[model samples]
Target: MEIVMSGIAKAFGTNQVLRDVSITLKEGEVHALMGENGAGKSTLMNILTGIHKADAGTITIDGVERTFPNPREAELNGVAFIHQELNIWPNLTLLENLYLMRPKRNKFGMLDKKAMLAEAENTCRELGIELPLTTEAGLCSVGHQQMTEILRILMLDAKVVIMDEPTAALTERETATLFKMMRKMKARGVAIVYISHRMEEVFSECDKITVMRDGHTIITKPTSEISVDEVVRHMVGRSIDEFYPARTTTPGEVVMSVDNLKPEGFDNDISFSLRKGEILGVAGLMGAGRTEIMRAIFGVDKHNGGTVTVNGSVLNCKKPEDAIKAGIAFITENRKSEGLILDFSIGSNITLPNLDDICPSHVLDSGKLNSFADELSKKLGVKTQSIHEPASSLSGGNQQKVVIAKWVGKKPSIIIMDEPTRGIDIGAKRDIYDLMNELTNDGVSIIMVSSELPEVLGMSDRVMVIHEGRVAGILDRSDATPESIMTLATGGQ
Candidate 1:
């Protein structure tokens, strides 16, 4: 299938999301769409699949004009979209989830289980996919759930498939499997629109690349023609000399220490220490108990045994309030659900955490709240019309900034950031790194838990690798190479 989108323009109130964007997708090719958050890449795709009508544009499939009324219509016409967040019914079996949308019925008007099973088995055999079809979806691994989505698309016989950040949550092995499936689809004359910020994957798996900036298409070229630097420059509209700032300050005395923390469901005890003005990076494979340790330390989860000492004082791990009252803040990995209330205004979200600062003497001060919100928003570079605007209105990168700002307002001495740069654009990542450096420089210690190896290596003063539920090893900044970290993460000595 060949698809062409030209002169696409969309506006939400006064915000012009897409301005004169154009792109072409050829048959049997993998085309990559690269951009920062709020760059209008998702908007363009939404318009193509009929999620939203473009204010002015034209889309043609196989040289014929078309505008699908809805995603279901697009899918019926051989177009499918698999979003980053897999839409799987956890309570149902894998087979049930796959055939839920289009179930076959027999002459008696009952469900045709035999037909569905045979068809699914045939497709799985052809694609080299193996899974327990009768098992519940929630019991399967993330990779399996993702493959189910892809298989569902293939079952539709989709000529064109659009993937948005397909491997964002997959492990290395799972990512390889996903790329292999893409190759199989390409051989069958299917077109793929791949959207991701991971440059390495795009360069390795995609045939063509298109970079978008500020609601406009900057350039579209073969993957071989453009360098990573050029693509980043085009996406950000400037050259970034330093994506991760160098750490210059020396850490002072230890501020927090964990002594043999045995969180529930852990097979081994965990221990770590954070010093003043230092960044302690936690790295591990998925299901390696990296997040479990953080949640237990922050009182979000129960610990069977351990003692947390903050500035030589024992902390009561009874609730999250204890940690917060002791001048510690946690930024969870699932920011949308735990970090911010989407319907609340940015100002209200900020005020939720620091009510004491905003409302002292048992009285609420509206003026003080506004000033506090304004101060943090401007300081953190939150791109919003006003602090009163709903948090849902901001982009992912900006919402992350708001989450950080919400904690920064509390003036905490110790901050724990889990997946700080996940799902954000590169430019915003640079901003967050700079902010972390500034925070550490000002004597605020940081515990950064990240899945991205480059991020942990680039921003850490000390790198701690966890294998299974145990602390594998800790290395100084100079000793934390990719090989060294991965070796420890995989249980190598």
Candidate 2:
């Protein structure tokens, strides 16, 4: 089936989100939609999946005009959307979540449990996903949860699958598995619309590329005819040569040291030293305890046993506040939930951590707060009309900047970032890389957790691969090849 969208226009009062956007997806081909954070990619996908209705447009599937008032209607018509944020019920078992809508009933009008389990198990195996059927969705790892979502779409027998940031939380091996599944879907004549910020994935996996900019369609070209630079140029209206800035200063004395760190679900005797002016990368599979380790180090999670020494002085950290007061900042992986207070204004969010600095003598100093927010916003190149606007109104990239600014105001000696560049666009990613370089030059030690191999390899002075709650291996920059890291991450050595 061919999916054709023409003259799509949508708006939220005075904010026009999409205008004159057009795209087409042919059966058996993967079409990638690339754009900046505020670009109309998500809006357009929502309109296609019936999450949002287009104010003006014509959607023709298989040469027949159709109307979808809701997602159920679209699903019934063979369209399914795998959102970036998985919508699985955490409390439900994998089989239950997968077969939630479609249930086989016995002759007595009772639910057919055995058949459902068998079908779910078979589907998962065929997709090369090894998820326990009886395990609760919440108990499964992030990678498994993602696989469950993909299985749900497959179970629906959807003809057109729209995947939004499908590989955002996936590790290298899991990403390879997803690519294989995508190829299988294409072989089965399913039209796939892939939305992603990673340019390499777009060029490597997509048959055609559609670039969107500021609520409008820029162009749609065959993948063979375009390069990553060209696509990024169209998305941001500028060319960025060095995504990761060159390191300015060499690493000095060790600033932070962790020895024999042991947290729940991660029992490995982890020992590592972070020196000033160095960025250390933590790479692992989704369940490999990378985030848990960071959380424990930053006192967001309790450590069963460990010793943390900063500047040769042992520090007691039992809570996030303790870590903050001890000159450590943590940027969470899920920025929306853990990092920012979305309802607050940009200034409020940025100044939340350092309220005392902005408001001395128990008096609220709005002027100082605004000045700090403005300075950080300008420094980070956060695109916004006003500092008083709600943080929720900004794009994902800008929201991330607000999180960074909030912590940067504290001027922590050590910073831990988990998936810092997860959902942002290319332009914002470059900005973040530049910021990391600047911070390192200022002698701040950084501990970064990322699932993207290229980013882990490019930004880190040394890479640590974790697997199954253990430090699988540690490699210096010169030895941190993709093959080498994967070998350790997958337990090959």
Best by lDDT: 1
**C-alpha-based local distance difference test score of model 2:** 0.88
Off by over 4 Å in 1: 85-96, 103-155
- Note the Cα lDDT for every prediction shown: 0.90, 0.88
Lowest lDDT block of 10, candidate 1: 168-177
Candidate 1: residue pairs that collide: none
Tens digits of per-residue lDDT, candidate 1, 1-493, equal 8999999999999999999999999889999999999999989998989899999989999999999999999999888899766789989988999999999889999999889888898888877667678889987756578778877887888889999887766656557777888998899999999999888899999999999999999999999999999999999999877668898879999999999899988978888899999999999887688888999999999999989999999998778999999999999876786899999999999888888877878588889999999999999999999999999988888999999999999999999998888778899999999999999999999999888888899999999999999999999999999999999999998
The per-residue C-alpha lDDT of model 1 at residue 10 equals: 99
The residue-level lDDT of candidate 1 at 213 comes to 98
Candidate 2 residue pairs that clash: none
Question: What would the per-residue lDDT of candidate 2 be over residues 1-493, giving only the tens digit for each residue?
Answer: 8999999999988889999999999999999999999898988989987889899989998899886889888898899999887888989998888888888888999989898988887876777778878999888767788888888887888899999898887766678889998998999999999999987888899999999999999989999999888888899998978667776668889989988988866657788889888899999778888988888888878888889998888878888888888899999988886899999999899988898877878688788888998998888888998989999999888999999998998999999999999978888898899899999989888999999888899899989899888888889998999999888888878
What does each candidate score in C-alpha RMSD? Answer: 2.7, 1.9
Give the range where candidate 2 is weakest over 10 consecutive residues by summed lDDT.
Answer: 240-249
Q: Which TM-score value belongs to model 1?
A: 0.92
